[model samples]
Target: MSAFADDTAKDEWKFTLKNAYINRNFENENLKDTGSWSQAASLFYNSRMVDTPLTITDKPLKIGVDASVQYAVRLSSDKHVADTVLPFDRETQSQAPDYLKHGATLKLGYDKTLLSVGELWLDLPVTAVDASRQLLTSYWGTNLKSQLTDQLYAEIGRVEKVSPRNAEDFQKFSFTSNGKTEYSDGLNYIDLRYQVMPSLKAEYYFGNMQDLYNKHYLGLDHSFNTENFTLGSKFKYFNAKEDGNNFNIDAQNIGLLETLKVNNHTFGLGYQQIIGESAYPLPDGFLPETYFINWNATGFFKKDEKSYHFIYGYNFKDYIPGFNAAVKYVYGDSFKTADGKENNESESNIILNYAFQQPFLKGLALQYIRIDYNVEHGNDFGEDRLFVNYTKRF
Candidate 1:
């Protein structure tokens, strides 16, 4: 950037490069004792796509380009299994490692508004896919976001293609793992957030996933800060219905979470209820719309299920900066499955995270997550995961 910058120019266009790598170790105690340890790298080139060399423009608008390629290499001791190391070396759950994760993107922006079209990253709750494994899930579509006012913001988007975090190549919208059907309607969304007061804020989101399903979400957040601690509360509700043939499902989910943070210690309690449906109609879609404090393992959304979670966290910043730990326990019951029998389940999760503050590794992070799920009737399993992540920008 320093080499391309010139104060004399009206608008400056700079080219840059960045890269990220992740080493993941995923172990399962109940799934045939199989584990997969893999390492993946994504190289990003932030440059224009045009082949011809063009002069830089100095104007009020800023134009940029981005492209990325990701490759995954499984460890020598490979235990080939389903759902082992996702988005990496797997034929059933994801694409094999040979298919590289690649995409090209273009951006046009100025001031507080921006327009993006191409293969891009959209992390919206129900719209965003995962990158937890070796590669990230990117969407093919267009988006527009702008700050309408000092207290209000709006975003609108239409995503036509999806390459899931655990899959290679783009596919159409579907509720199945292998997407053999494509939808021309695609997915559309509109979201808005407003700051009602210094201590209160509200957000609304609406999405239509072509002929599959659609959802409406409303949320409110309120927080209070005192000399000793801070208190926060969130309330969210969502209603979903099938559009055409959504596997015959319609559901409503409501959630509430309250947290109290005092220095290094924090505690939280959350509750979520799933009403109606054949599992919320989001099994194979994007992330669920649940705001539960303990969103781990299975979503715990059955035909008629109620879930409760307890959480505790601590930030060891005083002793070690950029270090934190948290644990949560969740239980779900009062569920009616296909057999008309009551089902019950429980889950426990623990995670430890550390972010590097050292100058040489400022953007590096390490995390360990362990989750245990117990079902009264269905399958029971436990997972242990370790992640080493790094990111940087110059």
Candidate 2:
């Protein structure tokens, strides 16, 4: 026993540590009074994979465990600003001084299939957890993934609860509309993907929230490659409707994107439209993954809205290694509010990113984002965000 313990102590464990600081301010008079200066930290651990005697197709079973914890706080001289920026508990009606999140999961694999149970992250078209904030949202449930053939894949899962990005504990899933919120029993989903050829792929997804709503998604992606440049195109569609005992929900969304990459530069154009009486509905605190081309800080999912966007990006690796920049602009109009008020809006964003190339700081990176937004007859605001990240594995 002593020898075994000594040997184990000599081996390094797999872990990661992350830290971030974020600051945001608004331009509107009503919103300028509140600002945010927040800090966050996270730790993750993954156990070494172990091979077990259980086998399905002459291959040994693999088992593992993963755990993570995240904490965040807001700093400000003004109490009102601090309270407004920090995480808030809707039920408690107060600011949370420190938002702490901890969870664990078990993983099992055999040949072409893998199973995960407990707290986990999901990235499906209709039910993806949002990870753009300080802490990522997570779900409590089970998921199974399998590779059926060389070019076909499938995933099925069920989640009962969720830990929101700003919350400390997991809670039941809920849907809110028109100042009314209703909780659902759970959510079930299935996803399928097939690679028709080397350059074309197709995907389909279906999600149902018990007694709440049902959603369906279909997507197609294709690309053409050449020695000098590459061209790509993507199309996405979504349909959603109410289930039972919920609000009357009927929505449809369609998006198309085209891109061309030449040397170190890329250009993109996109169009998105909403074609129903109701605005697109997503799970509370969740975002669509790769299903919405016009989704940025603000989405163009308003009822009967038509939006168009243009994007330009350049990679400066040859001139200045580890540097890239991009700018995007979107214009949306032809939408009406619930009270029949005409509205139009526009948004522009600038993004810059850099990563350290030196061996001593190989995993360190920095990012900056700027946003300018305007509404024809509503509040207007501008925002800025800076991020620093580092990661190491042992």
Candidate 3:
């Protein structure tokens, strides 16, 4: 039993449990007795498909289904898993346990056009996506995309809040009054993407974050790909205002990357800088992804921030009979109002990720994160995390 099980009144392993139910339902109905369970099984499959991505082929009408389950454990409280000081807890146990972790995405695609609805994992204006650290966060929405002409295309949609593992079995947040309290209302946004040229793409986004935050985003991405080398650059602008308050901010993020691939080995380098104005850092609960990788590193670092990261990975063409290992490192700075004083401080952190890929067993990933923080104007404490997860795809 996990330590959190003893600390909390309810079983914290709901996610794992729900995952079991979903899998068993599929096996028993679809495989055990196809004729008797046809209707029920089809409905179950359709729900899964509604939330998954559909690949576009030559056929306009296409259908497919897929799902995955992830079992994870965190050995340390270091929330942003990296190699750092250990957490203060006597037993850093699993935060979310035995949770049903699966979603199905569907596609209604035609020609160069596609429509997707159901549960989705999104990376939009970069704020919300950057801030979420969990691997699986799903949104209920529809994405309408089109390839207008040969080189131009666009995407648009609206989504609910981020739902992590065990979401189906958990009690979700709701509101009695319109935007009166936190976690009561869902977020809505519009995103646009245009490919101006073969190497460059531009994106614009606008959204209302319930009653707490309103935001705008503009970004440009350029890529250079060749036989053995790839280089990429991204520049983004984020503007946000606190709802029902006299607070607003403007921020800019510039990122550059270069990668060299040799057979099964690859090396890369990256850098990012944030500049803006705000009295204090954004709330820790919102936007955490700007700090780390794994797609869910919520946006916790505040505005007026500057950070850098380095990555190194090598793939063995034929190692361990049929497996490969990859590793990455990230380091950067965070800023916030200094200890309730009328000053601010610059914090630093280091994060790392390692994964082992085996053909039959799929892949197992381990994440270590550490934030060594301090205040230029006062006392300081930091956070550390260690996480391990297993993933299989068919």
Candidate 4:
């Protein structure tokens, strides 16, 4: 069964349980060893999309609510470790407490347009919540989206505060750059997508962080299918500038990715370059969107950096049912440090995933990931992550 209830149903609730284990071994050249291991268990409850009892202008009102709680413990003996291993309470310099997050949203539809308010999980080119960890981020905001025309869609939204993936409470939009922390009152964004043709699409996005920074994105995607294989191409560009005099930031990012798929095997090649004096900046706790092809355990967005990556993936469903594997390798160079020195970095990842197809384990899934990262002038690390998840709808 699907995780969400059928739209025809008046109301429904779903629950999920997940367990995760992560371990990292660091070989630092300048700092002490920061290796650590951690374990976490999370429970999530979500209400299916349902219409409310109220209506406006003959249109039905819709609402949704989602909540999650997580408990994590450090398995390694070290109390001081990287945030990826375990978050620490800054004030007390101790382990962080259990986490709780919840959000509710109401949507009103009119024709081809929809307006949503209250808590939201936004996924835009410029600003998006990060859900790669034990919990996902949520925002207090309002958004409006509309199908402007037959092939064009538009969206505009404003967010006031955010509850970060690792944080327990909501806070103002803030990010740290060049050893300084800058705070923003709020963030506003506009997004547009257009289907140029049957096989091509174009996108544009602009975002402004009040008194902080401004970001603009442009992208194009196209695909071609043939009898033997399918080929896809993606191009993305970003421009970042300081919004006010409070901070100084200027950067641009350009990336291109090409992919080919032949039956169960997929291959990809990508290149990304940063052109400016500063690194590409994002919200402190958020992850890079799809435009950033070189974002992995570490982002290759340093000053004047150029990166190249390759990917290969295989699906075993034809032979081994519900199994898949992938490997990615990235190398980046030509980055300048604060002291005028150049540095380089490399990252490699291997992933294995399986989902049970048997009736008794219908909703069971398992995944394992391994990452190896090395930097010419920084720390090197090897990390492993394992996840066991099960879901049921009632």
Clashes of each: 3, 0, 44, 0
Error of 1 at 290 (Å): 6.9
Off by over 4 Å in 2: 1-27, 32-35, 77-85, 90-94, 286-290
Q: Per-residue alpha-carbon lDDT of model 4 for 57-167, expressed as tens digits?
A: 786555556555555555556555445434566677665544455666665555456677877778876456664555566787889888888899999999888877666
Per-residue lDDT tens digits for candidate 3, residues 1-394, read: 1111121222112121110100011122323210000000111222211212443453334333324343333322333221111112225532322223345556564555656666565766523432113334455556666766665556676555444322322122232222243442556677777778989988778766565566677777788787876666666556666654433534455455555566676666666556666522243223334422222132323455555545555545465433344444544455555454333443344555555555554455555555544445544444444444444322
- Candidate 1 lDDT tens digits, 1-394: 2112222333222222222232323234454454456676667666432222333353345556667776666553534554434443435433244336678777665445666788877756576556444566788888887887889888899988887665667777676413434353588899999999999999998888888778888889999999999999999888888778634657888888999999899999999888975566563434443344346667776767899989999999999999999999999999865677788999888889999999997778888888788877776766777778777554
lDDT of 2: 0.77
User: Candidate 3, which segments miss by more than 4 Å at Cα?
Assistant: 1-107, 126-135, 165-184, 225-229, 242-276, 279-287, 290-300, 308-336, 339-389
Candidates 1 and 3 compared by lDDT, better number: 1
Give residue 354's error in model 2 in angstroms: 0.8
Model 4 alpha-carbon miss at residue 309, Å: 0.9
Global lDDT of each candidate: 0.69, 0.77, 0.44, 0.76
- Identify the superior model by lDDT, candidate 1 or candidate 2: 2
Output the better candidate (1/2) by TM-score: 2
- In candidate 4, the residue pairs with backbone N, CA or C atoms under 3 Å apart (3 or more residues apart, or in different chains) clash, namely none
For model 3, give the 10-residue run with minimal summed lDDT: 33-42
Q: Give the top-scoring candidate (lDDT).
A: 2
